[model samples]
Target: MRKILTLILMGVAVFSAGYFFDKYEKNTCRAGVAYSIGNVDQKFNVSEEQLIEVASKSESMWEKAVGRDMFHYDPKAKLAVNLIFDDRQQSAINETKSREKIAALEQSYEGSFKKHESLTDQYKEQAKLYDELLSAYNESLNSYNSLVNYWNNNGGAPDDIYNDLEQKKASLSGQFDNLEIKRNDLNSLAARVNDLGKQLANITSTHNSNVDHYNVQFSAPKRFDQGDFSQNTINIYQFSDINDLTLVMAHEMGHAFGLEHITSSASVMNALMEGQDRSNLAITADDLNAVKIKCGYK
Candidate 1:
């Protein structure tokens, strides 16, 4: 009888322990994951406060979509979200800077090209006017000389005829002065056009050199696993900006929520970052369904 009672007590104790343990686990899981900003490398240049703000926004994306809390922010939480600065992030930054330099060079080149075009047009118009004026001046000079020669051959001219010849000479002199002014203007335009051409050539050379250097430096395609959730921690490897960071954080948080990759490319739980609208980062129907299924939501 004593032996049977001991076995019964042992069985009750085991069952009680197992029941409480299961209940505790269920309650803990219902409470959701607690996370906080962990080690933020100084090289990332982001303060802890800023990271916390970003983390809150990331948390809200999941909670708002599922209509329940999926993550809680606790400063002492073991689930640390760390910003680790490494070659992945460095390469992204370098590529961005290089593209910005190329864009600036392109804009400058375009402006210079347009100015050069405008100056060339002005040169053409000024040259055309100068040529026409020279032709007119030469024609008038020939007529005046012919009249003068005729009067000389006749030994003398009537006063009216002499007066007319003087008037023609004065008019020709004025025309010559006008032609001289136009010639100077045309020459100035030509000089400006030449200078712009040299300027444009220099710009082209510099732009090409920069492009060559960029190609040599960053020709190889790079792939990065921007962020990941492992060992009770989320590590952000690379991101272009705050918006990108938010998406990465949300994706990792989805993993922490016990959700696996979904088939929907637009879902935050997608294994690959494709078709996701980074600007308006939010969970999709698939993501919400996964959350509901995982958390046993009605």
Candidate 2:
């Protein structure tokens, strides 16, 4: 009678364990870890089957560690494997728009340069004209002084010669005044050219900043996993290598299993891997321990 009672209790305990596992699997959607791959198929150059295969392999790593089918494929499951484009593409778009702005500024610069070039030529011509007029005035003044000396040394000077001297001097004085005005205009044109140069420098600086901003955005060479735990969705990006792709899926799926990143390099939950050490892709003893703890497995 004692042996029979022990056997009945053992059978009941085994049945209870099976029932609990079934309930746990159904409640957690572990039986069918339904997922959808995103439309970024072309961007990654991977087929749907390839992506699915990688995800399944990643899932199997965890499932094997727990010694059970923890997750299965379901098309309508809230869990998902999605390919996402990094902000680099948006940064590229921003850079393109910035270039367009610079292009427009360049167009404006061309116009300003042409205007400055024309002004430069005008300034040169005015300067040359001023020099010639000054020389002529000096020569005329010298001739006038000589004539006066001639009159002083000799006798009665012609009234016409003095009149001609005065008229020539007055004409030369007017020309000098006109040249001074042209010089002022040339200075103004030079100031405008300086301002245009400053504008071009500003545009060039802005273009450089846009490029620097893009580089900063894209420099990390890393991937991202986005999941809120509410939707069971995992969005991934920035990984191109097959091994890297598998690593991200496994890591995020581990999160779905309530596993956190451990400090050990032996575990896949190390936050980031260093090299082509595919060993990181597998579930380590520590990882299995974590799953056991999370799932309350003996």
Best by lDDT: 1
Q: Which runs in model 2 stand beyond 4 Å of their true positions?
A: 1-26, 29-32, 87-230
lDDT of 2 by residue, 76-154 (tens): 6666677666664345345556656657766776776777677667767867876786687678778867877887688
lDDT of 1 by residue, 62-163 (tens): 889888766889988999999999998898799789889889988988998899899898888888888888888899899889989998999988999999
- How many clashes (backbone atoms < 3 Å, residues ≥3 apart in a chain or on different chains) does model 2 have? 0
TM-score of each: 0.77, 0.44
Candidate 1: where are CA atoms >4 Å away? Answer: 1-29, 152-174, 194-224
Task: For model 2, give the 10-residue run with minimal summed lDDT.
Answer: 221-230
